[model samples]
Target: MVNRVATYPYTTSMIAENMRLQVKYSEINTQISSGLKSQNYKGISSDTQYLLSVESAVDRLEAYNTNTNIVLANVNTMYEALGQIEDMANSMLTAVTAALGGGQVPTAVTANQASNALDETQSVLNMKIGNRYVFAGTNIDTPPVDLTDPAWVPQTSPSVVNSSYYQGNSTITSVQSSESHVINYGVLASDPAFEQLFRAYNLVLNNSGSITELTEASGLIRSAIDGIANVRSNLSINAKSMEDQIYQNEQDKVYLKELTSNIKETDIPSASVQITEIQTQMEAAYSSSVRILNLNLHDYL
Candidate 1:
């Protein structure tokens, strides 16, 4: 009986080099299959660190884009409410003109009409979208105005009777849009528009039927009504502007998503073909490695 041992024809260094290349390819393929390139700097080699950073940044940018989309949606909701408010103000203006002419006496203004307008105004004031008030300032959960109280005056705090309470704050807040700019259009409850109109609402409903009351009160009411209209016009413009911006942002997001998808999302068909080819190559390499490691000079005999 004869015993034979295999002699590896390949040098130790060559075998080590081939194993290293295969290991590197395996790592890259793993990343491709999992759709992530995040690096463990503490664990991985320095060569792969750069790829990890790039993936992390892509994830961050996408997160920022998602947040921007949310802001845009909130701004869109606010714009809708603002437009509705403008319509409400216009309707009030028409009522004011009728009241001014005495064509419609304040006495004839049904409790329904009075209450309805007040309720509608309150609805406007307490409007909520995305859990935030369209009109209420920073403290949104608390509604801006409370017209439910029969004694509740429209604008003036405590009582419409108070002269000093006529003025309220007039600061605006903004919502971010994805279009790289902001939509500045948050009118607070303390805005002059509502405060003055509230006064005029009280006077319109309360004034007794006197020629002098009609003369003086009607003038002030009409002026305030016009002011409401002006604010509504401004809001209309803002709404249109925001709509335009939303459209533009949508286009921008489409492009960005494409870019990110190219980097992150997989092409299943291409990847499947690649996997098959890699499997075939791996089989060939294994066979070749086995052949090179098993040489016998006794074969010549």
Candidate 2:
């Protein structure tokens, strides 16, 4: 005859407990391996709102940082272009000064040099970073200066009556550096200094064969050199401001990342200890369940 010991209920309870312990152990192991408390928002039930807020803040800050980097790159490009232009202006001034001091007439060689300098200045003014012209002010899609077109005339005379060769508007370009800060780091090709340089070069290229014209051009070149020097100084100041803003943004990002990590990242040491404990419990439950199931009247006898 079979022994009627009510063992079925105990076996069923042990099986349920074993399944629970095994699931918990697997979850802990996964968390320890992945080093994240939760893979998704649904799994992060505790402090879910706070975690979400921090994540959103981090995302915004990352976006701002990306924008700042792009703007900084553009600013650097502008600075380089300006430096090149300044160097070109200084060379032109020196050549013209030497010619005036020697009382030499401007020759074909001088005209060629002036032409090359003018072309290079125009090219730099129309320089593009990506698809946008860095010196175009608000008209980023348009070239700032167009010296190649024969139909184009100088709109501004020596007295600054109207616009110049630059086709762009007067509006300055600004970029968002941070939540509270915006930077106006843009320079226009139509700036008075650039206008003076372009005009002086044009005059030299056109009438370099005459002594009187060459002397007049030399004076203008000297004035342009001084003007360009002042603009370069201002640009240097703006570049430094951009650098400081970038540094501050990086610092803020570090703090924000740390905050997000504290909210979302798993504690590896604690998770490891919990996983070991759960694994031990599961092993014990399995052993106990197997022994209980194997027991029968024969063992008792």
Candidate 3:
């Protein structure tokens, strides 16, 4: 006679094993569907702090890039305006030089040219970009040059000095290009070069009858030209430096994004394979449970 072997214990063990397999299968499926190792920071516990820091860095860089672009635009605008003013100064110098050589001042021509230059220079200094006068220093809403004001006087000291025509303060425009850098790009209407330019124009307009005065004005114009050239050169250098910083910020952002992806993203292909293997194992377990449940003492005998 064959002894009875109870199949209850075996069947119960198989069910428990299948339940465990089901849980594992579900987890792999979730990972595959979500394409993330975890839904929250707690899932990526060890790297969560580092990821936060990197993300914060990216945010800071983005802010810097935005602010830098605005500063760069203003800088370029100032550079262009300065270029026009410099050309005007050169033309004035040439005209004065010609008159000095001929020993005959074309008073009307000189006056007309000076008048036009003065008008244009005033407009440029009072230039507005989106309702803000770029040359107004910290006074964004006010125009920096107001030659129509009776109180405005051309300096007589024959030295480079701030223009009395300027309505703005002495504040310089600047921006934070990066964590370690602050870029100053302000070119105010009250700059010494601008002062000299206005002085030269007035000298030509108001004192064209005196050859001595005209000669003094010519010297001032030359000095103004040199000063403007220096300003433009410095602006060009600052623009290049800002561009480089922007590029570096973008590259750093890319790197940080890649790092975040590595920490947060799941390996979909690997998880898919795991799910397939778990499904196969569950199927085998089910098959074994069925077979073992059907076993009987008579059959064994």
Candidate 4:
């Protein structure tokens, strides 16, 4: 039996060209299967570029969120401190308005109550949330008034018994909002409100409960207390606004994540189908290559 010879010429150029075409098709199929245009660093360009960038920006966005949260939390500390100040102010005013008599009350004026009030004022200055100073102006790490740090206050007395001495700088500092705007954060101890209240402390302490001094300073301190309350209200409003923004940002972040996933993330089902198609084509090319390479001079004999 004679075997029929088929005409076949497998030149280097033809073989090389066929190999290139097969490899190209295989790559496209592999890409579809892997759900990626580029598996290694070399094949890295595609629509996913933007998705990768957005994912990277999440780190920065999250950092901004952290700062915004800190500001909101610090506002809480300020409110609590203001409440303490208000309580002291109200108590002092009560003592002043109440008519003191020999039988009912001690005639000798005691500066002790005023002293405690001054102590409360110090607390307002030294307000801290966690380990950070909430009212330290720009000095976040260092206490605004270092009572024990030995830098600002060398053996500084926690109790400012002498209200005549102003506790802190009157300058006010603000905090950044979650929206990148500045908002009034908290009041400084040297604020006008505190100054007026301090006067009352001085009057009561210096006069030693003289009804005349108590009455005069009472009005000033009461007004100051009211002012502080106003400031506290403002801060609360600002904090609530920031909180709302943060919540909104969180939603936005979720949406962005979804967008990135859709753009960049690979689908397993689609990838599997692509891989199977590429394998079929590759096998066909391999068979053709074997048939051509098998042809020899003996076929013409």
Question: Which candidate number would show the highest lDDT if scored against the true structure?
Answer: 3
What TM-score against the true fold does each predicted structure earn?
0.58, 0.74, 0.86, 0.71
- Tens digit of lDDT per residue, candidate 2, span 54-151? 77776777787788788877777787788899899889887776666664644677888888998899998888898998888889899989875564
lDDT of 1 by residue, 1-301 (tens): 1223322333555467667657756755775677643334443354345545555554554555565556556655655665665565566556655655655655557223445555666676677777766566566566677654455543322224322331223446665543266666666765555655555555545553444443444454455556656666665666666566656655655665665455455565676667677677667777876765565556767
- Which candidate wins on TM-score? 3
The per-residue C-alpha lDDT of model 1 at residue 18 equals 65
- Go through the candidates in order and give each one's C-alpha lDDT: 0.56, 0.77, 0.84, 0.65
Candidate 4 similarity to native, TM-score: 0.71
Report residue 269 deviation for candidate 4 (angstroms).
Answer: 3.2
Q: Order the candidates by TM-score, highest first.
A: 3, 2, 4, 1
- Residue 61 of model 3 has an lDDT of 96
Please give, for residues 1-301, the per-residue lDDT of candidate 4 as tens digits: 1224433233555567667767766776666666665575445556656767777666556766787898777788788778888888888777666523333444343467776776777666776677766665555565454333222221111223332343344446665544455666656555667767766666666665466666667677778878988878988898887787777667767887887666654565766676676667767767876776676667799
The Cα error of candidate 3 at residue 43, in Å, is 3.5
